[model samples]
Target: MRAIILSGAGRYADPWHPYAETSARLAELVAAAGYDVEVRDDVDAALAALRDDVDLVVVNAGDPDGPVPDGVEADAQVEVDDTALAAAMDRGIGVLAMHASASSLRDYPAFDHAIGARWEPEVSWHPPFGEARVHLVGTHAVCEGLDDFTVEDERYANLRLLEVIEPIAEHEEGGVRHPLVWAREFGRSRLVYDALGHDARSYDSAGHRALLARALEWLSHVPAPTADDRRGAAGPTSAT
Candidate 1:
């Protein structure tokens, strides 16, 4: 299948979270998974590549330095080409909104529908970057053959959930469990968002890397690993 890794910017960039390096690594990761992967930093170029044959669009960018919509105002401004993006998604292209990408394209409510969640400034907060334990919330194929694991990255919280999502990973802190990974459906398309991966180092965790690869496979409707996909999360399985 053909996949695109569109990235370059991230929210409040810093030395520790080099978006370019993270994007490069992720591109290679997806390529290793047997996809004809293309990496681009331009939204128009990426969107332009979404054709009838394109199977997946993985958004890894965030324009924290961008501007808010003409009328809406916010602390950090991250805009996206919601018009073009929503069309592709509605037409059944799989999407993976990773890390800062979830917070991207804030001005467009269409993005909320496409991503299933959006970053709510001030209200949305993350703890100091460190080891975060993400546990499985359901028996979804995206988390197939995966177990709860820990990673060193930004743990996003207080996000504005736009729909009822089937959470796959999360952590509990201060008596509240924040979802770290989730799967949702939009129109004829599917989406998976993993809140981990603050930087290149975040992929060092084997479990995190596996989840990324597996999520792509699931979103693309590729058969997921089934040998041991049933060992985690004591809950009802999807009866599909």
Candidate 2:
């Protein structure tokens, strides 16, 4: 399977401030999962490159702080190129959203369609920094190999999850419930969204890694190859 990771959104203004490292780590994880992965910061180029070779697109639409780049309009919380992204999704490519990505495509219909949910800031503020246990609520492939787990990090609250969801992880804080990870099918592809990965520790969390691995495997429609497939083949290194 081939994958493309779109990161470094902050680079249009400050190259050093780009989250390229985080995105690179994500690409490494995907590559280690036995897929060819490429990382790019240019949104247009990323979309253009997805014309045929890409099977999955992992967009880390970073924080919406810097000014929108040339030829890209900032509409609500979504960038103008989001329409093109929707066009790509419409073509049946698997899409995955990470961290603050839920807030990136705020009012775009295609983004909503691709994400399978809409996020509202009023309802989705988790403690700025804390620990929350994630409860698995389904048996979908995205939740495969993972059970209930806990991670200490920022807990997001007040997210309006899509109606069609096989929740893999639910966050409970102060007796209130919120979704942390979930999977849903869109068109002919699978889409998974996880509200984790706000910090380095969250990304490094074992449970979160497992969830992401399973999600990638599910989205690519490629089962994990057996040990024998690794013999004389360029297999992915262990990510665990």
Candidate 3:
């Protein structure tokens, strides 16, 4: 198995801070899952390399609007090409959309549709740090071994959820319930989005890590890790 990580934009721009560290740590965890994981900080390069051999694609949200960097451009066609590749890969592959990734491709309809939601300005984080209770609502393999649990970190609001979705987690705040994690199928492809991973702590949380790992495994159809796989499992280290 092989996974490609795109970690070079939106809130992830660099001095190699927490976001970068979290991405690296996530890649390491993917590697530990018995897959050859390749991480590219350049969105264009990452997209270009998405042909075959890559079993999964992980896209990190990057800078909101500071130019598309060296490899990536502001071209919609490029975005469409990338989305098409991802969708094709999804026939039997996996795609993980992290934190701001939901908010990353506003201009690309294919990407927005594939993700099952488009980020709106109204969508913002609730409290920089707090314990959010997430309720599981899906029966997919990704939710296997996962129960309703709480994570200490940021929560998102005002997401425009598309019609196609199998919600896996929900959160109620101020008496309003919202979907926190969900899975959707797009033309034979499996797409999972978690509105968490906003910080290092959230990514490293045991519950969150397990959910992420399971999501990847489910999308790739890899056998769920058994007790033996967990024996020497190394959780992500601090990216600070």
Candidate 4:
């Protein structure tokens, strides 16, 4: 499989600054999985490079703090090249939007159609980053034999989900539980979102690494790879 990681923004991992370091580890993991991986900060270059052969597109960047780059469209930071991105998704490319990415395309409804959710900062909120226990939703391969795990990361709360995505895991903050990991179906492909990696320290968490690794496996295995399609489950099964 081939994958492209789009990252680089002052706010992608805002106030934490983990994208650079953690993204390196992510690339390593992708390489270890035998995928031809390339990392780029230019979304336009990514769109140009993407082809039918490419299996995955990882959006690790979010709304920029300063002016959006030239050749790229932006009405402030709430901007993304939706036409290019949506076209790729329409052609069956898998997507993995990590951390701040949900807030990346907040202004583009077309982008939301593929990503399944949007981060409307005005309404959505998360508490300070801390050690939070994350509960896997079910026995999906993404968390196959894993048990309840904790990670030192931001507990994302109150997201705007345009479509109903399968909740893979969740966490409780201030007595209120919130979904932390999720998967969505877009056209012929699939996308997985993991809210665990807030910074380098969070990535260092053992359970976080396990989930991230499994997430790659899950994202790559698109269109329901096996007979046990977790998408059809009415609710989360027993956690392993």
Best model number under TM-score: 4
Once model 1 is optimally superposed onto the true structure by TM-score, how far is the C-alpha of residue 224 displaced, in angstroms? 14
- For lDDT, candidate 2 versus 4, the one ahead is 4
CA lDDT of each prediction against the hidden true structure: 0.73, 0.67, 0.68, 0.71
Q: Residue by residue across 170-209, what tens digits does model 4's lDDT show?
A: 8886787788888877566788887766677777778877
List pairs with backbone clashes in candidate 4: none
lDDT for each residue of candidate 3 in 13-65, tens digit (9 for 90 to 100):
53323557768878877887778877776576456556666777776765344
Report the CA-based lDDT of candidate 3 relative to the real structure. 0.68
Q: Rank the candidates by lDDT, best first.
A: 1, 4, 3, 2
TM-score of each: 0.79, 0.76, 0.77, 0.80
| Highest lDDT model number | 1
- Model 3, stretches more than 4 Å misplaced? 10-17, 66-91, 123-125, 222-240
lDDT of 1 at 100: 82
Ranked by TM-score, the better of candidates 1 and 3 is: 1
| lDDT for position 154 in model 4 | 81
Runs of candidate 1 with Cα error greater than 4 angstroms are 10-16, 64-83, 107-110, 222-240
Candidate 1: how large is its RMSD?
7.7
Total backbone clashes of candidate 2, pairs 3 or more residues apart or in separate chains: 6
> In candidate 2, which residue ranges exceed 4 Å CA deviation?
11-18, 63-84, 106-108, 222-240
lDDT of 1 by residue, 68-156 (tens): 33443334433445566666665677778888877664554555676777777778888899887888778887877888888888888
Ten residues in sequence with the least summed lDDT for candidate 1 = 222-231
